[model samples]
Target chain A: MKKYKILANEIIEFIIEKNLKRGYKLPKVNEFQQTFGYGKSTVLQALTLLDQQGIIYKVQGSGVFVRRNPGDLKEYVALTENLGFYSNNQNVKTRVLKLEELRLPPKWAVEKGLPASPCYSVKRIRIKEDGPFVIEHSYYSQQSVPYLSREIVEGSIFSYIRQALGKDIRFSEKYMHVVKLTDEQAEFLQLEENDPALEIKEVFSLSDGQIFDVSRLVYNYKNSKFFSQSSDEILS
Target chain B: MKKYKILANEIIEFIIEKNLKRGYKLPKVNEFQQTFGYGKSTVLQALTLLDQQGIIYKVQGSGVFVRRNPGDLKEYVALTENLGFYSNNQNVKTRVLKLEELRLPPKWAVEKGLPASPCYSVKRIRIKEDGPFVIEHSYYSQQSVPYLSREIVEGSIFSYIRQALGKDIRFSEKYMHVVKLTDEQAEFLQLEENDPALEIKEVFSLSDGQIFDVSRLVYNYKNSKFFSQSSDEILS
Candidate 1:
């Protein structure tokens, strides 16, 4: 068991020694195991740990690659396409909070860069996969999304917006920050007071530059992760 | 002072009562003071408080309004946008870790859904408006972004990429969760041992469906707030 960890560290050391660049592919897992004379499970465990450390990444059909420099503390993701689709088959538990139609005042208009219009508001909790992931609050412009109803919002709001309102979310500007969980947040997420969480704020804009929506996403960080790919300078 | 709070609450109440949606302009500051028989300072203080609560927003030349809700807590931008950009500008400070190009292993490739190719990586700490906003670690495909150097990463990595690589960021798929701060993370962010913080994982993709970047953004949420907007049904 210890040998496998040593082997994994050795692999990392080799990469560092060679000054290998990012995206450099590694040998096959079978080969690695064979070379190290380690069991598949041992190799897998070590690899998994390294992945968690943001050291390496695995490509499905392909092999693995060195992801970052040695002693790098930043987190990285290898894949980031085909997202934003909701699954109807999966059963996700939810708890609803405030839901209503709200008119935009000057304050909101300025924030959203909208021309001061009426909007809809919805707040809910979502639980899926490992645990409760996030508390979501959403707002929509009434003029843009006419005839929004409680029933429509009951299912997948993203689907409804796409199907009924014909709104296509092209891009979003996102801001991530850390926040101490409030009593309500902690209770809802089933954590103690002051448990840290990630707060994701985004503004969705259409391809034509119209600000369509804005939202705040709060998540439990212990069981979650984020992924992305960018140039070295961008990452710096 | 009590009257000021009352007047501010009254303004919010009026918006809700009248169903004034987002972007609905409020009366002028002078008008508010006259109507409520309050001093300008009092009225301004109340407005400022409301603004801070995100109950209202303001435009420089335009008046204030009740804030319109934007949907998708994970994608909302109102709170941070108003706070100001987290920049490495004069007011912001940055602590650079190590910067270098390195090869990613198969584990990272699989996570990124890549083909186990060579890649470049950079790591750094971003500090400016507040405490450490994020410790960024990034990985890039060498095939796409060649000629990346450590010197280039010391400044704004995003700017370097756009200027040097001509790569434009179109969208990103993000994952977020909460975690207790590790001794290292806590020390770096200047928090107590085991302080809770928000962790965000993301995969940034380009317009042509190319996976370009991945990052994990951690935020210190001790004194901060996070919010998201989504349809009510998603809560279920």
Candidate 2:
């Protein structure tokens, strides 16, 4: 990481540690220089980076102030990562609606990279404190996963895949569509049919480049927010 | 880039070059190995990557076949990238609705990183051959932009900023929300009031870390699809 980015992260930690609220004045640049022992330019760059990210703001001739508290904003689902319900939601629980072992993987599953052999198909509703936030229909290749149980499904399957099975998920490809909820989906999310929602189809590959999982996630339109940040490398 | 990724890109180019149609059979793995002079494993890896991305599908005994032709699927607005309508739409044109200079920037604009001095505010409706696709409300810091014109706004402002002003846009941060369109927004998008849409708020920074632009975009609910892809590094 760049020196300025390291300092920016430290500043964020300090803000969280001090429980700074919005509009609370921060220490001056020289004051931070004395504390962190960084040069003036480095400190300024760090602050500028933070300001650009909406973490803090500067007033002319005045010192910096907090724009928002850390964690005050709603968490956004990073589009590039695998779906992990545990990381974002508090007091979350899973209700497994269906878990079946298929003798011959369905045509859709095969097209999604599941082999023609046996596999596990799961339908789950992820509930937060307020209500069901997502409905997921997932297919796991038995060739790679080899095992599935209701107890594991209720918890974190990704964790089980990593810790218990010793598999590392390397990357994911996702396609998203803006869709209206069907009656069954609406009933699952406790929303009305025809309500707009986001449907994400995802494929997961393991470290060895083995495609082992495919999932379709439908998020509750009212409760979900997504965020993305891109650098020059991503520009067309 | 890795050798396999390079090969995958080459394969994509080959697909386009051959004008491969849906269900058209591609050259066998050996043929690709002969053409690219890569090892069998490398060729397989490239094919696997393409399969994971929904570009091709392999039959058990039959050779690989094209699942969809190049550009067959509707283009998805990559969540991590800026809103570049030109890249995705055909015959896209911009209709400048409002453009003016503000002596004292709005409070919301200031909060979004525009300096308190003079700036340009613009409202534009982007139309495609079908109809209006997006409505954008944007604020550009006069300190960075320096000047603006209706002719420029009717074209690509970002292109003008890069090509004419020689200012490099280094990065952007985006926040997305699922929203119901207001009556005014509905009229602009030619949709009914309360229609679901994606609202994206974005802040763009220059190479030197100056936040020069902030924009709010409302995408037509019926015509928009967004995509995101992440690696292990982006996992929470």
Candidate 3:
């Protein structure tokens, strides 16, 4: 292996092992060269190589720091167990568009195990600072678990269900499809009607296999990205 | 749980255990009723629920069939071990955009453990039957493994390496982000400039810890959806 390549690998291994988040400044060039006993050009080349990978950045006046874009598109694995829209990597905000009591259950309410009975229907728009990102239509079994207000809908529903309602988010089956946006959905997202969007539907069950909730999320194709990584899984 | 829900759960368990693929038709209504000894309403209600979840479909004047849509957008787990653009769910076509020799390796080539020298660079555009979808740029160490043709590139590179060249895929790491499309990328995809695009970067290593390959893929937002499900994991 080339000397500089070996040096680059060492630096990369260091960054990963350190578990450094973004904005972490690395040691100076001389410091790196002295510690690794590598020539100046070799160390410099290693740094340049890492920069090209978008792993770190070199400021004109300041030292090199880990590269972390504030507005970079993050993704959701869309796991049914993760029954909320929250990202510590970025600011996630939810707006309750419509909240009402459904006297007559929606025609397909039983899809998520909710019977033909009254339920709480909640509509929300999720934003991540850039703009409206996803519109969500969620249904909760009112008879089984009731007394949720609009305020609770604004925050993380998963946390609320677990911490407040004492419900367990066991697992879910999810289906994903791409479709043209409807007029109402487009208006909520301020996009052209019939524009492409990605839809994900999930039916979640509690520990005892009782229906907990059912939701369909429509993501604006313009700025949304979904990501997932696992040893045995497929992307999307 | 309601009687129909119990029926639905039993049907779901059967699907998973049977390992039914897309387009695998289920039993007829009378068949289901006789097999489970359930009433007509109970069986019909369970079918209705599965239809809502996009699992099955009814053919008028005929029996029900398993659901499969050709244009359904699919996602990747973005694992480096995935190593190719092939998907078992659909017919994926690859068109080589550019293939060249890197006289001077890209600065980040070594970051993926490639030596600081010449390498084979590949660019490809992947399309499903619906439309053009993802653009990929990949690099491999020329000396470590040589002799790749356009035909091999069109198909699965991982398959060729493992079956033809006798190499083992050890593991891979991936990074994902969402960003505005570059003018050139948008033009290639026939999309609007600055449209949202999902980018995934992967670095792979062989079983011997040698650098296998590094690639970056960009996907058009219009007809793309990613999905991942497992027993133990949550949404990111």
Candidate 4:
């Protein structure tokens, strides 16, 4: 076999030429190392890199195997960077079921550090291609956006708040967890009873650290994926 | 009634005093305005400010309500900062289940841009206050960490790699989603079959962008939470 540096590429070509699909088990490492006349470390280095790229996965006690078709790599990359990628992929659409302004209660008022009177809330559903992906519940401080309406939410709410209102948004805090679908949420998302949904809760803040919006996005994971970035220090 | 500012604070104090909880509906805007003797807009402004702080949530067709337990404020704040407050708060204990070096297959080698040989795999279980919280499966490039051993992984694998090996880990790409537990994972996590779990798949990279590690973190959502930060521009 070629030297260690080129061995990884050669193996990839073999998989492509052989048409090995996802979940296809590979030959044992000892055999490959002997055939390639390379140290075990060299071979492992190559495999580890591939795994990081999302091309393969390892099942403990089982063995390393090829990953299933990852769909489109470009689309996946785009989805991570731009929400517009949803529309570009032609597989997801935003449907504004309802949008309105309403007051929040005293308890919530205190938690958000508002004057503790009333607040405004916006609700919408996101469709995946032709199917449903998530139901979104968003609450915004009217003081942050004085005049909100259904027409403004029809498109992208983020765009409207920034461009139209001239609100300089800065940073936000986000939380993700899993939750059993409420009966109402299940009905809205067409999920079965007891099915778990991924919940993304976010608090939007301004440059001055004034938080003005909190949103709960619940997604049916049977047809979706979420991605993020982290520092490697956490692993160490 | 006091002016709008103090009225807002009073509203907040009232919520706290009454010990309101999440999902507990609040009074309507008109009711609040009349009771507080303030302009409708002033009351709305106070509610709006509170919403921005993530203290309250609003539901259309319903009313404003607390979103999370008031007692969880400190934990919530730390979580938003990615401080692992929940794990720390619960004082979770980690146990090394298995750590070993194995040969990687050709497919994995190709995906990671490695030479298609052997790699190292580390597996462990993390418990929260003695109960299982998560199971972690990590794979490392043999070349990057050739001397990895079971003993080294016993403590914190992340700490060892950075301190001992002096590997310069920089950034990582992570994919988060939900998955139904398999029979084995369920048994390890001591949960029922098809129980939902939070799944995080990550790829670690060096400063130069070389792939160094791939890890999958599976957590019992009943006992854990995931938090992150983003720009408000994305939300607005």
Q: Tell me the TM-score of each prediction against the true structure.
A: 0.46, 0.72, 0.58, 0.62
Task: Estimate, for each residue in B1-236, the C-alpha lDDT of model 1 and write its tens digit.
Answer: 37767877787667766777655778888998888788999899888756544456666676776564332232222222211123213444567676666666768786865423576666677664557655667776666666667676667656666677776654344455567778978777787778876565556544343566666656665534443322111011
Most TM-score-accurate candidate: 2
Predicted candidate 3 versus true structure: per-residue lDDT over A150-201, tens digit per residue: 8898887777888898876655555665566789999988887867676777
lDDT of 4 by residue, A1-236 (tens): 33543766656666776777755887667876887666798778766645543355555577777653344232341222223334335555677876666676768777764422345677888776647877888877777777777777666777777789876666555667788888988888888867888887766654444567777888886866665544222211
List the TM-score for candidate 2's chain B: 0.69
| Top candidate by lDDT | 2
Clash totals in order:
112, 2, 8, 26
Q: What order do you get sorting by lDDT, best first?
A: 2, 3, 4, 1
| Candidate RMSDs in order | 18.8, 8.1, 14.6, 16.8
For candidate 1, the lDDT comes to 0.59
Name the lDDT value of residue B152 in candidate 4: 75
lDDT of 1 at B106: 69
Sort all candidates by DockQ, best to worst. 2, 4, 1, 3
Chain A TM-score for predicted structure 4: 0.58
Candidate 2 C-alpha lDDT tens digits along A42-157:
99999876764557766667678876454644466656446554654557789999999977637765575553357899899988777888899988888889999999998889
Top of the candidates by DockQ = 2
Instruction: Report the error of model 2 at residue B143, Å.
Output: 1.3
Considering TM-score, where higher is better, how would the candidates rank from best to worst?
Answer: 2, 4, 3, 1
lDDT of 1 by residue, A1-236 (tens): 27757877888877777877556887777987887788888888777656544466665576777666553322321122112314322556666776787766769676865423677777877776666767888777665666667776667776776777776544344456676789998887877677777676666644333455667777766554544332211111
TM-score winner between candidates 1 and 3: 3
TM-score of 3: 0.58
The residue-by-residue lDDT of candidate 3 on B89-175, one tens digit each, is 358888898787776646765564453347778899888877888888888777655867888888877778888988766544456
